[model samples]
Target: MESLIDKDRIQVKFSAENQFAAIEMAAKPLWEQGYVDEGFLAAVMERERNFPTGLPTRVGVALPHTEAKYVIKEGISILTLDKPVLFAGMGNPKEKVLVEILFLLAIKNPAKQLGVLQTIITIIQNEMVLKKIKGAKDPKTIYNLINQFI
Candidate 1:
């Protein structure tokens, strides 16, 4: 779980002007920890522009990620915002969603990305888990919830 979810890297009640800043905020720790390259943030921003990762799940989350080229190590950066941020819905440019959670993925292995994403999707789709996340007051609680699932 340390490799996937760095407890210290988790952000609770995170604030940002927009999704791009939120992504930069989320990716900072991973970058400082040597998990991702300098290009990680830029690549993610470009990817989001061309193809949004926002999901209209039970909790309204976004899964922003880029190619393995931007990754030095595999990890997931979770940010639970203080307020919901609007993001273009995935595969639906016309639609917009207020996302409270962001999962910024930095995966060095392309083959493992799908499985990891699927696991996260499964977690996000679970009503109980979504409830727990939305109700969580701090990073420890959120981290604990993920630990339970993982």
Candidate 2:
């Protein structure tokens, strides 16, 4: 299996309009690297708009993602926004969240999808991991920390 992260896909944006913009920005590196199709970015955004992937952490954070087909490569793209962005809540649709860290996952295989999700779940469950990610100052730092876990 490919590693959960592709350092090439990591991005650090100081200004993002919203969560959708963040996801699109994060996915750009992957798209340019030829790891994802041209349509993958748009597809992911559409899927998310219709079916949100926000997962509320026990300590307060959300992990959002969509289907594996949106992936051009079997890797993760991470973004640390200068400001939080609102995303539809996972556990409660009525609620909204300002997610600081967005993990844009791209997994091509359907069978491997569960494994990727499990790995992400395990990583986020660790308070230290979440804290480190939240504390990360740049794309490299975030990429390094995620590499340690997956």
Best of the candidates, TM-score: 1
Candidate-wise lDDT, in order: 0.86, 0.71
Over 1-150, each residue of candidate 1 has an lDDT whose tens digit, in order, gives 446987777888878899888889989888999999888899999999999988988778999999998888788888888888989999897789888898899887777887788788878989788778867878788888887767
Per-residue alpha-carbon lDDT of candidate 2 for residues 10-129, written as tens digits (9 for 90 to 100): 666446888788777878777887777877888888877777766666434445456666665676777767777778887576678777677777777767877877777887889888
Clashing pairs in 1: none
Candidate 2 residue 118 Cα shift, in angstroms, is 0.8
* TM match of model 2 to true structure: 0.85
Off by over 4 Å in 2: 58-70
Local lDDT at 32 for model 1: 91
| lDDT, residue 79, model 2 | 73
Which window of ten consecutive residues has the lowest lDDT sum in model 1? Answer: 1-10
Clash count, candidate 2: 2
